[model samples]
Every structure is written in structure tokens, then in C-alpha cells.
Target: MSAAEVTAMPEGRGGRMTRAQIVNAALALGLIGFGLGAWAMDETFLVTLATKVAILAIAGAGLNLVLGFGGLVSFGHAAYFGLGGYASGILAHHALNYTAMFEWPFVFEGTTSMPVIWLTAMAVGALAALVIGALSLRTTGVYFIMITLAFGQMIFYFAISWPAYGGEDGLPIYVRNGFPGLNTLDPVQFFGLVCVVLFAMLGLISMLARSRFGLALQAARQNRQRLMAVGIRPGGVLLVAFVISGAITALAGALYADLNRFVSPSMLSWHLSGELLVFLILGGTGRLFAPLAGAGLYIALEHLLGGVSDHWQFFFGLLLLGVVLFARGGVIGFLAGGKRHG
Candidate 1:
């Protein structure tokens, strides 16, 4: 290729939007339209259903950052997800009951504010990622995967044993907590809030994927030795990506807990982590909108098959297998007309 040809091509894939991008954007808008339509029809349940999809998509996006872009397969991401839920639940529990979180050098008070709780959750999640990444990044391949899972299980059992937070029974937030000016009790209003965050996170990931850091991370994944030869430390790039990924996932967890008004050990389970991975794979690995598409389809299938039969997951597994074996790029990849390496 000539210099001009090389220069004309944009970073990551190409400067132009991919088929996946176009489809994903349309799907997102469709979701918004559906939510608004449901609100008008007085079908509040549908609005809540859409809101659940948005929240789960956000969580899947968080995992995609590491697994898709960063080339790190973490089987224990539920740790961050659960931590975020616990953060919001614990704070709201205290705030609703009129108790202080702690009385240290300065009095630590609980808050029912959504913004405050989200900030706390993201911070805690990022910290956990930093610690976990520091240790796990020391290894590679299956060892890395196992180390991450071990860290996740450690937190899971800790939460189970902590009696202050209801132990294995779990904790509950009596109310959904307060956002700035909106009446959060209204289904559509709360859905709007979650939608805004979901799109923002999606856009953030889009920009990050095209940035220099994202390029370096992808390069490290493809060839760590080459990246090292170029004077970039692969470990540092992966560590940063992991931290950001955890923060995003945790944010989703907090929102999810608020939506349900409950936080349980199930959120921290390996099953949830596996499900997040499944979402990515079902949509298309490494595609910008894969998480959203995957989450939408997964939720839809669950709602549909669940109502028809008690063993819905058996059918779900068969579908997942079909995708893995026949559909190389997942649903998006199949529709977009190409693989996801781009």
C-alpha cells in the first residue's frame, strides 16, 4: 500500500462506519422509541423490560472492553458487578434506616442520592479492578483466567459471610434512591436516566477503541513482543483497561440493583459472569455494538422461552451453541456481512 493509502485508513478499522455501527445505532434508537411508545400506551411493564435490557447491555459493554478489545478473558467480572450492587444497597440501606455508615476521623454518612451512590460504586469497583489486575496480569492464558476467577470467588464468599449485610439472604433498598430532579418512581423517567448512561458508555467505548491507547492494547493482544519492542508496556495498558472495564460494569450493577430494589449473592455469582460473556459472544466479539445487540436478544429469548417452558435455559444453550458453531460473528456479524476483526 502507498503512503497515502495507509494514511487514508483510520485507526482500528476504517474511518467510515461499519455495518455493525449502523445496525447498533438503529437498534438503540428503536429501544428509545419502544420505551416512549410503551409509556404512552400505559404499559409500564414494557418500559421496565426495556430498562432492564439497557442496564444489562451496559454491563455487557463493560466486559467487552476487556475481553474483546484488551484480549483478556476474565471469568470473574461478577466481583465488580456485585460490589457495585452492594455499594449502592449498603448505602441506601443505612440512609433509609437513618444510620451512619461509619464514624471514623470524620463521620461517614449514608446517602440516598443516585449520583453519590454511583460515584461510590464506580470508585470501589475501579479499586477492586486495580488490585485484581495487578496480580492477575502477572500471568497469561488459562492461568490469568483462573486467577481472575479466584479473586471473584474470594469476594463472593466474603459477601456471603458478612453478617452485617444480611449474609447469604442479601440486602434490600426500600426505595430506588433519588436522582437530581426527576421523579424516579415514574417508570419512564427512570428509564430515560438509564438510557442516557447506557448511550454515554457506548460512545465512550467507541472513542476509546479508536484512540492511541486502544490501538496499543489491541496490538499487545495480537503481539505482545512486538508491542514491547515498540517501547510500550503491555501490562500497563492492560491494567488500565481492566480498571476502566470494572468501573463501567460496576456502574451498571448499581443501576440494576436500584431498578430491582434488591441486591443478592446471585449478582456476584459465576453464572452472571458467564452470562455476560455469552452476551458478547452472541452479539459478536470485538464489535462496538455487540454487547447491546447480544443483551437485547438474550433478554428477549429469556422472556419468550421462559413463559413457554420451565427448562428455558436448555433451549437457550442450544441457541448459544448454534451461534458459536455456525455464526462466527454472532448475530451482528451475520447481519453485518463480515467477521469482527475489523
Candidate 2:
């Protein structure tokens, strides 16, 4: 093959837009159209489902960063998710009840503000990720996965045992938190708000994946020794990625709690962690929209199949098996016409 032919490999697959890019565009438009259509028809239930998709997709994107890009298979991501949920729940609980969260250290109090909750959630998530990553990243392979799982379980049990937060019964907000200049009580308005956050985070994730730190982190994943030989510390790069990933997921969790007007220990369950992983695998790991695509499919199938059969998950499992066995690149890769490589 000539040098030019090899260099023009991408052209052979696409004209103006690559298959993946086309797929991405379609997915984005499809989601927006779905939400708008639902809003127009006053289908509040469907709109809420769409909101769930956006929120869960954000959480899955967080996992994709660590698992796909960083090659870190963390099984305890639910820890951060739950923490974010609790952050929203706890703060709103105190605010609504007119109680101070803490009287000491400058008279800290709770807030009913959504923006404030999001910031607090991210901070809590990042702090937890720092401690977890510092220890878990010290190991490799399954050991790292197990360590994360263990930490997640510890948080889960603690949440269950803590009576102040309603213990196993979970905490409820009774009302959705307030947002600036908007009636958050309205379904469409809330949906619009979540959609905005979803896209913004998606843009940020794309930038991080293309940034210098992103490349370095990818390098560390592919070849740790080579990354170090180039004078870049893989540890620092990975730690930063882990913390950022956690913060993003935590933000999603905060939104989720607000959407449901409740927070529970179930958010910290290993099952939720598994669901996040499932979303990535179903969509296609390492792609920008993998999390969104996967979560969309999962939620759609659940809603549709759920109407027909009580044991809908049994059929869902069959479809998931087919994807795992035959479509390694997941829904996006299959539709995009090729498998992606890290």
C-alpha cells in the first residue's frame, strides 16, 4: 500500500462525517426530539423517564472515564453516587426543617439551592475519590476492583446503620430543590434543566478526552512504563482523572436524588455499580456517547418491556448476552460499522 492510501484510511469509511460522528449526531438529536415531543404532548411520565436517562448517562460517563480511558475497573463507584445523593438529601433536609447542619466552625447551615447542592456533591465525591484512588490505584487488575468494591460496601453499610439519615428507610426531600429563575416544580422545566447539565458535562468530558492530561492518562493506561519514561507521572494523571470522574458521577447522583425527591442507601449498592458498568458495555466503551447510548437503551427497554412482562429483566438479560457475545463494540460500534480500539 502507498503512504497516501494508508494516511487516507478515514476517508474510505466516511465522506464529510465519520460513521461514529454521524451516529453521535443522530443520538443527540433523537434524545432532544424525544424530550421535546414528550413535553409537547404533556407526557409527564415519559419526560421523567427521559430525565432519568440523562442523569444515569452522566453517571455512566463518569465510570467510562475510569474504566475505559484510564483502564481502571472500579467496582465501588456507587460510593460516590450515593454520597452525592446524600449530599442533596441531607442539605435539603436541614434547610427545609430550619435546622443548622453544624453550629460550630462558622455556623454552617444547609441549603435548598440546587447549585449549592451540586457544588457540595462534587466536592464530597472528589474527596472520597481522592482517598479511594490513592489506595486503590496502588494495586492493579482485580485487586484494584476488589478494593473499590470493599470501600463501597463499607459506605453502604454505614448509610444503613446511620439512623439520623433515616437508616435503611432512606431520606426524602418532600419537595424538589429550587433553581434560579425557574419553577423547578414543573416537569418540563426540570427536564430542561437536567438536559442542560447533561450536555454541558458531555462537552467537558469530550474536552478532557482530547486534552494533554487525557492523552497522558490514556498513555498510562496503554503503557505505564513508556508514560513514565517520557517524564510524566502516571500516578498524578490517573489520580486527577479518578477525582474528576467521581465528581461528575456525584453531580449525576445529586440530580437523580432531586428528580426522585429522595435519597437512599440503594444508591450505594453494588448492584447500582454493576448497572453503570452495564451501560458502558451496552453502548461501547471509550466513546464519547457510550454512556448516554447505553443508558438510553437500558431505560427504553425497561420501560417498554416492563409493560409486557413482570419478568422483563429475563428478556433484557438475553439481549445483553447477545451484545456481549456478538457485538463487542456495543450498540454504537455496531451501528457505526466498526469496532473501536483503545
Candidate 3:
């Protein structure tokens, strides 16, 4: 194959593939290739693994808005992620059991529809983020971080004690939720569905990042006082970003539950929240394809190192340390020659 055939020639502003854009395009194509290869090999497990990376990438993308652009160090994103999972699981549970979600609320019933589940998950995630952001945004620096962490823990403990939906044991979703015209039971089909959502969200984030609001958000992060001087309310901007971030993460959570056929308090754990952050950092915070890059690398490491030793995480930590110490711009930065344009 010729070089032109292998490398994507997608045009950018100057009719050239900027380093960052090239990196993003390459990562996306890599994911598509991985998924296709898995399907071709009849490796359902690999297909499912690809789906996991896409789903987690969605969550990481959500977190990146606040952490990367808005400079918000929220440690409670797991609350929203877990909430999204519970939303889908609980709805599927009630649907399976033929139970009403509520009687007074116009006799609402549970749904197995993927679209419905996703909408509900986004709403719930946005609401939770609103509440969390409203309170957490009141502080800054370590205070904001601690407050977010505390809220996440609060949700975690609540889920553990709530016996209605399996409590500490978690809830099981027997059947995969149905998409409009897809056989969700088929791993390849399910992976495609996830890939679509992931790409759509990525496009949405890319647009937002380039839009006027995104600029303001970034400015607020760089200097809230300057933003205030320029007539923009830094708090409000940050709050909106946080809500959007939460909703996106929640959607990932919902998909993740369906992927595993299970939802549990562990999803709400602080470790998961940290993992989301790690995904963004590992891939390249603030970059468009950072989430995918981070998630793919993380999963690859987990599989390879996990097979060799249980203490893989110790070595993983060392690699992460190296990335932090040397390649501060992350995988994308390292690949793009550390120019940091995106």
C-alpha cells in the first residue's frame, strides 16, 4: 500500500493534517480497525473488550471537559457514572419483573429500550452534576476536589445500603437492552452501537471545544478573575460544563452496565472516579482523542500485564509515573512531537 493510502488525508483549516488532527484521526481509525479485526477473527471476547474501551472513552471524554478545559478537578464523577448505570439497570429490572416505576407519577413503567435508558441516564446524570456542581463550584483548588470526592463517597455509601436494587451485591441485567433495529445480543452488533455513540459524543465535544462557549470555559479555567472582568460568570460557565460532563459520563455508565449485564455500588467507588481521570491523563488531557488513546492503552496493559502477574498495577503505576514525569502531554503529545496544539 502507498503511504497516501495508509495515512488519512482529511483536510484541516490549512488543507493540511495538523499534528493534533492527524493524531486524532489515526487513533479513531485504529479503534475501528481493532473492532473490525476482532469481528473477522470471531473473537467475541475481543469485540466486547473493544466495546468496553469505547464506553470508558465516552466517560473519559465527559470528564475531560471539566478537568482538561475547565481545570476542574472533580473526584466525584463516579457518582454520576454509577447513577447512569443504575438508571439503566433499574429500568431493565422493573421491565423484566413487570413492575411499575411509580404510580403517582402517571403510572410510569420501566423500559428496555436503549434510547429511553440513555435519555433517562443523561437526565439523571445532569441533575446529579447540577447539584454537585452547584455546591462544589463554590470552592476552588483542593476544596473543590475534596468536596467532589466527598459527594462521590456519599453516593457510594448510599448505593451500598440501598437494598431495593441489590444493595452491595449490585443489580443484574439478564438481557442486553434493545436498540431500535439491532440484535444487541450479538457482540459485534453491540460493539457497533457503542462505537456510534462514542463517535457522536466525540464530535459533539470537538464542536464544543471549538465553539465560543468552549473558549470562555477555557478562559475561565485559566483566569476566573479575568473572565469575570470580561463580563462572563466563571461559576455559571463551569457549572454548565460540569453538568454536560456528568451527562456524558452517565451515558457511558448506562452502556457499561448493559455491556456487563450488571450494575453495582462498585461503579460508584472513588477508584472508578480516579480511573476516569487516569484515562484522560493517560491519553492526553485536553486533546480530542485522549480518551480513546488512554482507554485503549489501559485495557491493553491490563490484559497483557494481568496475564503475567497480579502485581501488574505496581508496574503500571511506574509507567504512569514516567508519563507524568516525562510526557506530561500524554500519548498524543508524545506522538505529535510534544507540540501541544490541541
Q: Largest lDDT belongs to which candidate?
A: 3
lDDT digits (tens) for residues 53-106 of candidate 1: 999898898998888888899998999999999999999998898888898876
Q: What order do candidates take by lDDT, descending?
A: 3, 2, 1
Instruction: Candidate 3: list runs displaced more than 4 Å.
Output: 1-11, 340-342
lDDT of 3 by residue, 198-229 (tens): 99998888777767788788888788999999
Per-model lDDT: 0.87, 0.88, 0.89
* lDDT for model 2: 0.88
> Which portions of model 1 show Cα errors greater than 4 Å?
1-18, 339-342
2 versus 3: better lDDT goes to: 3
Question: Which 10-residue window of candidate 3 scores lowest in summed lDDT?
Answer: 1-10
Which ranges of candidate 2 are over 4 A from the true structure?
1-15, 339-342
Candidate 2 lDDT score at position 89: 98
Best TM-score among the predictions, by candidate number? 3
